[model samples]
Target: MKDMIPVDRKMSTMQDSKISARGVQVYYGETHAIKDVSVEIADNTVTAFIGPSGCGKSTFLRCINRMNDTIDTARVMGDILIDGEDIYDPRVDPVQLRAKVGMVFQKPNPFPKSIYDNVAYGPKIHGLARNKADLDEIVEKSLRKAALWEEAKDRLDKPGTGLSGGQQQRLCIARAIATAPEVLLMDEPCSALDPIATAQVEELIDELRQSYSVVIVTHSMQQAARVSQKTAFFHLGNLVEYDDTDKIFTNPQDPRTESYISGRIG
Candidate 1:
């Protein structure tokens, strides 16, 4: 395992949480997915959600951006606040909320459009750019942030699908950041990548914490230790424990968390 570097050392000052969830609950038709979960995610920090395969980590993650609204049978009940404003309010627009909170899925799902267009899509839809020149700059900057500009710059007009798996994943990340989102949610982003590709994405995730509040749901305990400053361990639809990465991994308070971390139970 690589030595984990502290992200706080790279920042001049600590920022307050960008997201706060209180009594969050989720249901999929008759199944209760998340049970009264609450957590506060700080700005410019990386928070990892970890647990067994069927735990509610992913379900609760979708609540942060209101992504569950797309499912007819999915229901969310809670007060999720971004910047102190309730995102679950009836007046809040899910489309606009998604724009503010970007997501990168488990698999690399880049659009069939050109590399430039894939990154430009979000900015265009959100009106982040005023004209062609502005859009070009946003696209370039986004790709650069995702650490794909050097490889993708010459292939701006090429199909996004033509890129390598890692490149395509980075492109998807570029697409997400293009909207200038304040918070970024990653659902097992490294799950589909090779070790080399996963390392690159992990590095990018650390770098991203300098600007955005990053929340990641990953099954790899090593990954959770490597990428996150804070860690939340979920079990059977319940948030069993949440604390500093070092404490959670080294000195967990909950017996369930200790069992999961020690590989005794999951």
Candidate 2:
């Protein structure tokens, strides 16, 4: 369905698509954390995933870059394709896959290195730069994209951990984009920021959609409405509703969706 050609064992060719999840399920040891979920994420758009705590929104987000694979007992069953390639394929390297599918977490985490080095880390490892000049350009471009270049340019050698929380988070975003990813997965990026910082990050998120497919998991409904063009509502591990931001917020077809939007359920 939807420009996809069926294949065997959780494999599919989703050409011209940014991200596609089919019959996705997740398990932690013996507990089933996510039920069968399916959705398609478009390129150059921001898709927000909203739900109550532990509703599997973040869990599903982690599946995109295989972050859950770090857990000893976390098992994922499904096909997650980006640009027609199956990320779970044996031939695919998770490190490289992560480069293509960058992520920013709930809390800002910058390496304990200079601001310049923090932004240049990914490019250095991925060989995106030819030399010091190239790395410097990449760092400057990434920081500008994250909207932190003007503030941090004078302090390039300063430790990234020395910046304010909001600046640190923006630094992390710069690092993520330095590798030139096609999809960006953010897990509640504004949860830890002040209102002003959140507003700035929100603005940056909107701008980022011009270059990459951004998928954000946010607890804030207003943030989702402001940043995303499409929205998906999850409940107790199931994807209850997915539609245009206006439709999902204004006139949801599903009762559960309406309840959540109306403050009846979460």
> Against the true structure, whose TM-score is highest?
1
Which pairs of residues clash in candidate 2, taking residues 3 or more apart in a chain or in different chains? none
Q: Which digits, one per residue and each the tens of the lDDT, describe model 1 over residues 1-266?
A: 23453445343255777898999989999999999999988898899999998899999999999889999999998899999999999999999999999999999999999999999999988888989999999999999999999999999999999999999999999999999999999999989999999999999998999889999999989999888889999999999999888778878999999889778886
TM-score against truth, every candidate:
0.96, 0.93
- Write the residue-wise lDDT of candidate 2 on 1-266 in tens digits: 11121122121222356899999999999988899999999888888999888899999999999999899999999898888899899999999999999999999999999999999999999999998999899999999999999999999999999999999999999999999999999999999999999989999998898888999999988888777878999999999999877678878999998888777887
**Alpha-carbon local distance difference test for all models:** 0.91, 0.89
The candidate 2 region of ten consecutive residues with least summed lDDT is 2-11
Model 1 global lDDT (CA atoms, 0 to 1)? 0.91
Error of 1 at 30 (Å): 0.8
CA RMSD (A), model 1: 1.8
Clashing pairs in 1: none
